[model samples]
Target: MNDDELVNRLKEIIIEEEIDIIIVGEPVTLAGYASEQTQKSREFAQLLEKYLTVPVKLFDERLTSRRADAATLGATMPTRNRDELAAMFLLQDYLDKQKSNNF
Candidate 1:
């Protein structure tokens, strides 16, 4: 879907789900340069932040899909590197970092 569609859907979900924070997955190339996907994700986050009251944070999403795929391997119904699964891994990592930094 396009960025506009994604932003609109996220707005709807934020309201419907009463979301407090938004964690955007930033696509970082292994070489450390920004790829087209990174640019698109940044644009999406920028658009989303305009309409959101809560904080919108970008998390590094390098290899998250691969990690998700590896984690679900040997399972009967793996998520097949689904975007949601990747996002979950990103968010979990973000949360873990936050927890660690809290100390």
Candidate 2:
């Protein structure tokens, strides 16, 4: 879906799920350098902030895909499933960091 469609869908989900915030994955190189995808992610986050009621935060997603692949090494799954797993890793990391900061 396009950005407009994505924004509309996210808005619906935020209300339907009563989500307080949105965590977006920020893809960067292993060396922690910003790449083209990182720029795209930032732009998308800006778009989300402009259109959505919930706050949008970007979290480092480096190595998430690799971790997902390792976690599913022996399993056979579609690419989309792997992508979803990577997203889970990203969100979990974000939450973990938030929890640590609260202490």
Candidate 3:
């Protein structure tokens, strides 16, 4: 999805879920370096910070998509994309941090 679509969708989610924090999946390469998409994601996170009252952060998304794909690849494959898996991983990381911090 484009930035405009993402921003709009995020707004809806925030309103619906009463979300306190927006954790974005950081796009990193296999070598643990930032990918080209990192800049775009960071920009998106910045934009989200401006529009939403909640805090926004970029959580490392390394191997999450791969792990998700691996988990499903063994079974009947669902037609899921990398982005969805990556988003799940990012959300999990945020949730874990929240749990630790008692947020």
Candidate 4:
């Protein structure tokens, strides 16, 4: 979907789920350098911030995919499931830092 469609869908989900904040995963290199994908994620987060009423924050998502892969070792899983697992790891990392007052 395009940006407009994504924003509209996010709006619906926000209202439906009573979402107060949005945590966007910022994919960066292991060395903490920005890549093309990092720039894209930053731009997307900016777009969400501009269009959504809720606050949008970007959190480091380094190693999330690898962690997800390790978690599902020797198992056959769909790409969508692996992506969802990576998202879960990203969110959990964000929440952990937030809980510790480190973020």
What total of clashing residue pairs does each candidate reach?
A: 0, 0, 0, 0
Cα lDDT for residue 57, model 3?
Answer: 84
- Judged by whole-model lDDT over C-alpha atoms, candidate 2 comes out at 0.93
lDDT of 2 at 55: 92
Clashing pairs in 2: none
Residues 1-103 of candidate 2 have per-residue lDDT tens digits of 9988988898898889999999999998999999999999999899999999889999999999889999998488898999999999999999999999999
For each candidate, what is the lDDT? 0.84, 0.93, 0.78, 0.94
lDDT of 2 at 67: 93
Give me the candidate number with maximum lDDT.
4
lDDT of 1 by residue, 1-103 (tens): 9867877788899899999999988999998789999999898788878977778998899989887777777354545446678888899999999999999
Clash pairs detected, candidate 3: none
Q: Estimate each model's TM-score.
A: 0.80, 0.95, 0.73, 0.94
Model 1 steric clash pairs? none
Q: By TM-score, how accurate is candidate 2?
A: 0.95
- Could you arrange the candidates by TM-score from highest to lowest? 2, 4, 1, 3
